[model samples]
Target: MNTDFQHGAMGPRPPDEDAIMVLLVDDQLMIGEALRRILASQPSIGFHYCSDPNTALKVAAEVRPTVILQDLVMPGVNGLDLVRQYRQSPATRDIPVIVLSTKEEAAVKSEAFAVGANDYLVKLPDRLELIARVRYHSRAYLNQLQRDEAYAALRESQRHLMAANLELQRLTKVDGLTGLSNRRYFDEYLAAEWARAAREGSPIAVMMIDVDEFKRYNDHYGHLAGDEVLKTVAEAIQAHCRQSSDLAARFGGEEFVMVLADATPGRTEELGTGLCRSIERLRVPHLASRVAGHVTISVGGALAVPEADTSPIRLVDAADKALYQSKAAGRNRATMMPEGVA
Candidate 1:
């Protein structure tokens, strides 16, 4: 018997992915030896023999053979049934199987094919013909495995590219200094919210917030300190806009805006006054600020039930006017858009 005919150690052989590996399951030791002699001359082909019909599937899985040569008349189990089991097992399901039988009857060959056998061979087949069939089936199976691996790699690459594109879009909408939504994103969101409010007959509130004497504060404390103050103020505003329907954004340098969907006038005023107190509580010292020793924000809010015919920009203008009133009346207070002010 050739040393290449392996019997007992059913553990997997080292992976030889490009090589043609064959697993033969036959009850007779003589038959295994005969097949071994036939394949041993071809160093490119590897062979494993499992005499126990019950463990054939296990050995096939461990060996990861590209083709299987199964004997038809095993003692305990039917060879056709074993082929069906191979088709059912995930590890060996795609492997090609060639059934060896003594009978050359067409009925027997048809049954073998019905049970998932790839080819049927008469016992002691011509060596040239056997080798040809083995090489043909092994080549086709290996090609399929390569295609599956390539497709999986392509899907993984596409997944990573989509994630990177989403991250890039989010970065564009964010303000670099304050980590709030930028003015462009704020405008887009406000328009959408306004249309929704109009359709639903809900009130929308907008607040224009300005840091007190920001230019003087920036001159007194260095620009870095000014950036820090803006970051802190942005955080305070974000804390107030906790609802999913509320949005806070950096309107421009030293200025911010908040949009509250479905808010009442009283609720809007409450949030505006609360935001002022929240910043004053931070106690970011502003020596140049005439409003307070610590940081304070002036808030001007406007509430409106949006109409389908009117543009949303008018609400923003109204809030800006109210902001001017707050600055004129000792810059620390919150003021509502006066009645009859468009």
Candidate 2:
């Protein structure tokens, strides 16, 4: 509530680039004012004053003064007690405290030092010596503060770098066009899934999808338009392929691949049918498609419980044969491979 204590006398103006602050604490109004005036004469130091120990503690957290000049004896809370309190607080613990007292006895000085005083000086002592000591400690305090700030900044930068690296890793595995797994990622995932299915004796289904008359559609519409169509179809197929075990990828050009782990023949068929219906609902106009309507796709699926000796190439061949059947039956359909084909 006391503005005089809250806002101390202005010191010699610091340069625009750099300024050091000092806090002067004393219960006596005259002593606080005199200290502020004296410190203000120093060009590098900015002075703050507090008559109450409580106010000084609060200001220590807010202003973060470099060097604290505290009178050892006071009416209520003495400087030694203030020094102890400041040293205990995490916020102001590092700040250097110089105890100012009229008591010049060694016992008084020892007691002040034991209470966490960094330095001790008698009241109204040698002005030049006092100013020299204040300057020395203030510079040291500022240097320490700068080091702490730099460390905090470095830690923050490391956190940001880690987050960015994680995002980059995620982007690498994801397809840019449809937000599905890319071909490279799908290849790795499929191989892992196949190995797991073989180990667990679970059925896995592989489907190869081809957009009917895709080359003709690309010839009719420019490559950009073909890309847009491909993206749309990919989205449709991905929508129908739901489940944590389901994997989809753009398999180059207008062809795509899907893997369904732990699926039965019936489940594979149902999923294939659902995907066919989803593409039909898209209503993407493909005038050049071989089918009766607009854009359409042919899906060939092969379901098998892989063995330890089974090769990846054999599974792909089975799926490719079913895709051929879908093309032969007429585009825009799903076909399953014969059990003994591979």
Q: What C-alpha lDDT do the candidate models reach, one value each?
A: 0.86, 0.78
1-342: candidate 1 lDDT, tens digit per residue: 212355323455333345788899888888888887888777778888888888888878888887999999978699999999999998889899999998798999999999899999998888998889988999888777766865367557767989999999999999999999999999999999999999998888889999999999889998989999999999999989879999999999999999999888788888888988888888989888777888898999898888897778988998888888889999888999753353
Candidate 1 — which residues are off by over 4 angstroms? 1-147, 338-342
Clashing pairs in 2: 11-40
User: Per-residue lDDT tens digits of candidate 2, residues 300-333?
Assistant: 9898888886766677789888999889998789
User: What's the TM for model 2?
Assistant: 0.56
RMSD of each: 15.4, 15.8
Scored by Cα lDDT, where does model 2 land? 0.78
State how far residue 59 of model 1 sits from its true place (Å): 42
